[model samples]
Target: MPLYENRINALNTIEIDQNLLKEVQVGNQSVAKTLVDKIIENKATKIAIEGWYGVDFKKIFNLIKEEAEKHNLTVTGKSSAGLYKSSEEIAQYSAKYLTDDPSFGWVNSDGHLRDLLNPKALQELRDLKSESDLLVVYGPGVAVEELSDLYDLVIYADYTMQPMLWQMWDGELIPFGSDEPDKNYFWKQYYYNDFYLLYRQKQYAYTKTDFYIDAVVPEELKLMSFKAYEAMIDEMVKYPIKQVKIMQPGPWGAYRYRDLWDIKGLECNAWNELAGIELSILIDIGLEKPINILTQNIMQRPLELVGEYVHKTFPELFPLQVWLDDGYFPEPVPWERSSMPIHNHPSTQYVQRHFNEPLGRYETYYIVESYKGSSTWMGYKEDADLEEWERLCRDSDNLKVIPNWEDFIKRWDTNVGDLFLIPPGTTHGHGGNQMILEMDTGPSIAGTEYSFFTYDFARNTWDDNTKTMTAKQMKMHLEHSFDNQKWIREGRVRSHHRPRPITQAGDGKYRYDQYETIDEMPFHIERIFMEEEAPGDTQGKFMQIVTLTEGERVTIVSKRDPRLRTTIDRLQACVIPASFGEHTYYNESGRHAMVVILRLKKG
Candidate 1:
């Protein structure tokens, strides 16, 4: 039998003020009508529709042009693409940041939106602004600093990440300066160069845009004034906010998600619960359905959302990631095919030197639910053969022979509420038959794909293209893995990584205990066992991630403001901002509750 039914609730929505909701206009026609009215009222001739990379600027421009033509006015416009650098120039300039490997690249720091624009074409466009009733500029980077004075009214077009990825997968997106989509190099270039360039552009546009448009759905565009957009973000940070969860299947995916979530057609491997760079948040604005906004946008109020130290440290970057690893299966499965690939992450100095990222990937796995044979793999065995293990891994990759991983790696029997700290250089993977809450440091704004895969136990994965299972031989970074490997043996793993919990505070009703972590780890883990209620505080320093591992339901409320609160069900998590200083947890169900809390260490 499965551990739970299909009770997974992935919606993360917050209700906002209705007055602001009324200001939100739906559909391109309505938004275009509003913009046309604004142009007439202000007697504006120059208009700019600046957009993020994936926005449909052509659709918006056409709608506005139609609306302007209705007023018996002449409208002339051009896409920002005309001002972009040549394709060869862009590829040459981006070569240093991108890597030979298709999956990885360094975050760009050397180029800006203006750097990508041809000065000659820019001057031509500026000079071409005519005496028509409306002179319009549309596309990404149209509102950049160089073109700031080119428009009298600026509207910023935005979309969420999921739809953008879908467009990328469908080959609908063409990279800047390139006429056609290069499937081979699109992901790396977009993540490393395009994302950062547009991110910086959006920051500047935020200050100057008179209106913001949610173009996630092209046919049904949502438009609001800059004031309303700012008000929405301000209201979001006032309380706990949850990011919309995204689930993915893997070669070693388990069947638990099939039972837990209302999803079909794929086995679930992991849930990206709080992956700030990858996921978005749903905002309830008294609409038929909640509007989706990128999770990183909430960081506009960095100090309020993440606190003083984190705001100073990360600076517009959401520094944490949370994932739920599904490992439950009703029937027995082969250990090789059921386990995760043996992998290790880079250290801070190592990542800085190699990838030009800000922080290293530090991770922890809190076992939320476990069955009879649940296990976790961490480090190496005390008596393992290192040289033979390396040879076998290479043979598995090159010769199609599965290596005896148990001979080299150590395994521990995991139980619910057990916390395992995995610092960089410490090899780790999740064994089957359990559910794990993986909390880790988000290393970059581009997205965290830093796990250096070593061995995959020679499994077969489903291929969407072929409609059949195919041999899954994942690329391995053995050289980097060996360089970062600490070779933590069984003794050190038991003594250092899995320290026994010490009671920090307790009363007759509730008990709070702190789990001792390794000195190198940057975050702290604690659990609260409550019979009815428990008190907590963020102290105005660090943000807190609260997950109900063993509770039916619990309500987290702010003591200062009783109106500010959210209820989380079993296995559901919510982020408590650092500004939510003092809060209390009330167990909604008349049963014992266990909540795991994670926070970054104070410097």
Candidate 2:
């Protein structure tokens, strides 16, 4: 029931407190009378309400008509070729007629799409631009801010498109090509239509558009170098192959049509390395011309440089591979070779590019101690970052999250002893052993261009003894680019001495806790534990929060406080928030009671 609906007693729905709206105006500038306020409005001569998330057709026409009428004119609703269903797609003869006019088109990823918008249909509307008419696009997540300057208007609401569309138009019908600035409004919209094959088949089956770099993910939960892969292959048996259309949507299927349900055999000899498993599948619609990204946290790609990259990788794939470049990706001011970028510019916003709904990513990674002989001052970062993974996984069903094979992999890697990438949302150094040799890049962990790395480390060279960035070296380099004040104040290097206590729930079995994180970032740190027989206090316990799967190890086998402790080894993480104490874990058996400690704060 709507909160407003429960006026009889306590309300649990949205009751528009007329006064509250005034307060909201001051409190949250981003929100207005409606949800989305259009940040940019360019008057296009011609266009179509082809589609976008949460939009309505009648509402679209009404808005356009109202805007047009304001100019003593009314919108002449012309049906573009694919305005409803492309005439070409429906009636073979009609297909040529509708498609002949390039102004209108559809978003199915089959091969027929010409440009982001069909060109022919647009030409017809060009005349209106000169007359000062406005073309209002009806779509969801179609934020003009996130894409390569596409629509003049956007309706950006997560769920309902109708109310938002009306509010932006203000009970008026706006026509295409209206250059009226004060009257126009909307939030930057975002659309994942380009990334899904499932959306392609039912509607615009033959229209294939070019895939862009906006879809590439910059960070992995944990890093897997050639060595880690080799170790994993040796330990795990070759899993059998099976072809099954998944019960749910998967990463591979989200991008292309034929890829919709083609998950086939998992080959041990995956890709170029025997270290990973390569599954067999085919693209459902467009066979994307593959490209790599030196992308940053924001998915920003310099427009010119993006072209250069595509030219390099897909020489044969050529200009046809396609891409959109947003100038948002941030790079080190003075490029640093000695260390990784303090704050990576790779774009999580690029997740918007995946026509694949529910697929967004936030990534952060760091170091842990190495487990070498006789406490030889060596140990690898633990692979089971239980606190971090749990949180990210908990919201798995919400965002178009990729499948959690990584979660299981992290656990398995833990038991067998291998380091995995830290889950995308954690700034972790397993519990309290702060070692040298840690590098990470993630989404907006902070609101500004600040990335915090500890410059204090014992070692400054790689295993081969080549000079590498010590905690000090990395810090010195970052000082040139970052505003260190915040780095010092908000995102200072983390350690046990400054351990931020994050509370979580425990049923004497599952334990976890909130880790610290910064604003503009969406991840929290957490700890987890399980133990069958507690280690003696004298020897000290082994607490690690690595990302590998602890195969066959139940919550009972691994135990710890699931809170931030510099002492224990083997911690697991889920993306739980701190302050609320939402991250906790535990294990049974007093003799082997396990404690898993972790930390979390919004990042």
Q: Rate the local accuracy (lDDT) of all candidates.
A: 0.79, 0.23
Model 1 spans > 4 angstroms off:
1-19, 178-182, 464-468
Q: For model 1, how does the per-residue alpha-carbon lDDT over 94-209 read when each residue is reduced to its tens digit?
A: 88778775557777865788888999988887788487889888888778888788788999998877777766776777567653555654767777888889888888888899
Candidate 2 residue runs with Cα over 4 Å from true position: 1-203, 206-343, 346-362, 366-491, 494-503, 507-510, 532-603
> What is the TM-score of each predicted model, taking all chains together?
0.94, 0.24
Determine which window of 10 residues in candidate 2 has minimal summed lDDT: 1-10
- Among the numbered candidates, top TM-score falls to 1
How many backbone clashes does every candidate have? 0, 186
Q: Candidate 2 residues 1-603, lDDT tens each? A: 000000011111112224322222111111211122221133333333333222234444454465456455434444322222242333342232223312221223232222233344444334334333444443321222223244433222111222223344453322222222224322211111221221222123112111111111111111112132222222111111011011111111111212211223311100010000011111111112211111111111112211233224322111100000011112222111212212212223332232111112333332222221101011112453544533443343222232442232211111111222332222322211111112122211111112233221222222112222222222222221122112121122222112343545545543444444545433333334444322211012111222212222222121233322211112222111111111222222243333322211211
Count clashing pairs, candidate 1: 0
Q: Worst 10-residue stretch by lDDT in candidate 1?
A: 1-10
